[model samples]
Target: MAPLRLSLACWDYDRVKAIEDGRVRPEGIELTFLNLRVEETFFRQLRYKEFDISELSLSSYVLTLNDPEPPFIALPVFPSRMFRHQSIYVNLKAGIHSPSDLAGRRVGTPEFQMTAPVWQRGILEDEYGLNYDSPQYFTGNVEPSTTERTEKVPLQLAETVKIQPIPKGKCLAQMLADGEIDALESATAPSTFGTHPDVGRLFPNAKEVEQDYFKRTGIFPIMHVIAVKRSVLRENPWVARSLTKAFASSLEYAYEAIHARGALRYILPWMQFHVEETQAALCSEGNDKWWQDGLTPQNIRTLDKFLEYSFKQGLAKKKWEVKELFAPGSLDAFVL
Candidate 1:
């Protein structure tokens, strides 16, 4: 029998590099990995369903669950995860010295439903007494020269939630630096953050803050998941498990490369110290540390918390259990 051919749209993440380089092919599948940025992959997949598989935003993907016929199913294959403390940028004029001061402020974001913002809002609300509904939001591009970017999936915000697009020719980064927007929450750092003196990170001590949060909660937020077209899953049930295994293998490959301390694989001067810090913080539950792939209780709880965040923020109509988000065949692959 001929192998099933599949195309996957996602960024060139180090964890997924083995798959991209043809060193980790899914069983019974011939894969074509599309090296796309998260924004491009998300826009194409959510707008046009352009790929057989895609790296989908957790918030956007969960919102699609509200559709009568959800278009995609996922495995426990998370391609991107990050601690979002560094994602929040603020204007020096905003008078937001601490998280509590962000209440009733003007905030700009590329999209209200982007995963990083979702995580940031959730974390702020959960840990710092910042209400999810407090901010007045403006959506636009981060770079001043580009046109505003709208949500990939339209949002039906709660009556109390206030949000709108930034004015024409205005972008989030520039608006933030100019103090047109008091703060910005996004996955990508603004070009103005370092160059423009007015714009600075909300949490300047981000590494310390994020490390403390992880130690307290053990919740490393997942940004993107590997999703397959639901129609394709209906035809080839085994694809889910095959792809999951492939992704798991790819992560292991990444771990091996990162652990070769004798000769550093990356260019960082403190790569060894960084790896040791990560292991100390995240390795207690599993050998994979921050990149664990299976649907362990920890992983499921992380997904559940994110879904709760999406629903509470009015991005999803209702919260969904983690099992409902992935393929039936893939569910069993999750280790206890």
Candidate 2:
């Protein structure tokens, strides 16, 4: 039988570099990898089902689960995860010195349903006692925009919350710099902050804050998950395990490259130091596998918390079990 051929769309992350370079191949499969921006991939994949497999926003993915017939089902191979404390940006003049100060302030997000904003908002509300509906939320691009961006998924906002688009030709970054919006939360750093001195992160010592958060909550905030089109999965159910195995192997390759101390593969001079720091911060006392795959206890705990937040924030109609989020074949190891 001929090997299955599939198109896979995802960002150029180190963890998936082995798969991209053809060093790791899925069993009985040939892949054409589309290296693209995360937003473009998610938009195309979610809106058009443009690829056989693609990276999806966790928040957006949860929204789709509410649909009676979702077009995609995911594997547990998370391509992107990060601590979102640093995602919150604020104008120095906004009088928002702390997360609590965000209450009753105007906040902007690139998309209402984006994963980064959802994590940040959830953390703020849960840890700092900020009400979910306290802020007047604005949705749009982060740069000097030509037009406002719209939500990719419908939202059921709290009755106390008010959300509107930024005026045409306006954007979140420009609004924050001008004090039109008190703050903005996004996965990417706002472009205006690089040029404007007045714009600063809400948590200046974000690393320390994030480390504390992880220590307390044990969540590394999953941003994007790998999903296969339901039609493709239905035709070749074995493809799920094959793809998961390949991705897990690819992550091992990434670990080797990052931990190769003889010659640093990454650009940063302190790349090894950063890796060691990350391991120390996130790993158990004697274990260093901080980024393990395959729905481990830690990952499941994180996913459950995320689902709780998603449901509470109205991105998900109801709380979904972690097993329901991934293909059945992906939940356990297959004996060879």
Candidate 3:
């Protein structure tokens, strides 16, 4: 039989670059990797079901699970994981000195259902005492000068959760900088973040704060996961296992690239020092430090926490179990 041909739409990140560049190939699959920007990829994939496989926002994926006939089946392989404490940007003019100061503040986000904002909202609620509904929300592109944006997945939030959009031709970065919004939560910094003296991070020392959060919670929040369309998955179940194993191999290759030390794998001059420190901090009892993708206990706990956030925040249509989100046996390893 001919190799299975599939087009995968995802960002070109180091962890999955091997597959993108053909250094790692999924068995029996003729892969066509489309290295699209995350925003474009997500918008196209979610809005139109435009690709055979895609890297989907975790929060958006959860909401889609509520669909009567969900169109996609996810693999436990996370293409992107981020700790979101650093995502909170505040206008200094708002006098927001701490997380508690955010209560009743006007906040802007690209979307209420974006995974980064979901993680940040959860952090504010769980780590601090701020409720998810504490802030009045505005949604718009961080720097969209003309085009309007919409939620990737349809949302039916609780009535108490109030959210609206920025004015047409307006942007979140400008809104925050102008003090129209007290704070902004997004995966990418608003355009005015470092350039505008009036805008600063709510947690200036977000690195230390996030590390402490990990030490306490063991959750490096997951942002994006790989998913295949339900039609494709039902026809070829082996595709799930094939893609999972390929991603695992690619991730290990990335780890080795960083560990090689013969040449700097990343741009940072102190990359090795930080890598070693991260490993020491997160890898007690021999865990992988770079947040490996799989359905291991650590990942399960993390995913479960996100599910709770989704359900409580009214992002999910119903309370969802973690196992319900992924393809059967996709996270398993076959010993050779």
lDDT of 3 by residue, 75-157 (tens): 98898988888889999989899899999999999999999999899889998999999889999889975679878787888
Model 1, position 124, has a per-residue lDDT of 93
TM-score order of candidates, top first: 2, 3, 1
lDDT of each: 0.88, 0.89, 0.89
The Cα error of candidate 3 at residue 113, in Å, is 0.5
lDDT accuracy of residue 282 in candidate 2: 96
Alpha carbon lDDT at 281, candidate 2: 94
In candidate 1, list every pair of residues with a backbone clash: none
Q: Which residue runs of candidate 3 sit more than 4 Å off their true CA positions?
A: 334-336
> What residue runs in model 1 are displaced by over 4 Å at the alpha carbon?
285-288, 334-336
Ranking by lDDT: 3, 2, 1
Would you estimate the TM-scores of all the predictions? 0.96, 0.97, 0.97
Which whole-number lDDT from 0 to 100 does residue 35 have in model 2? 97
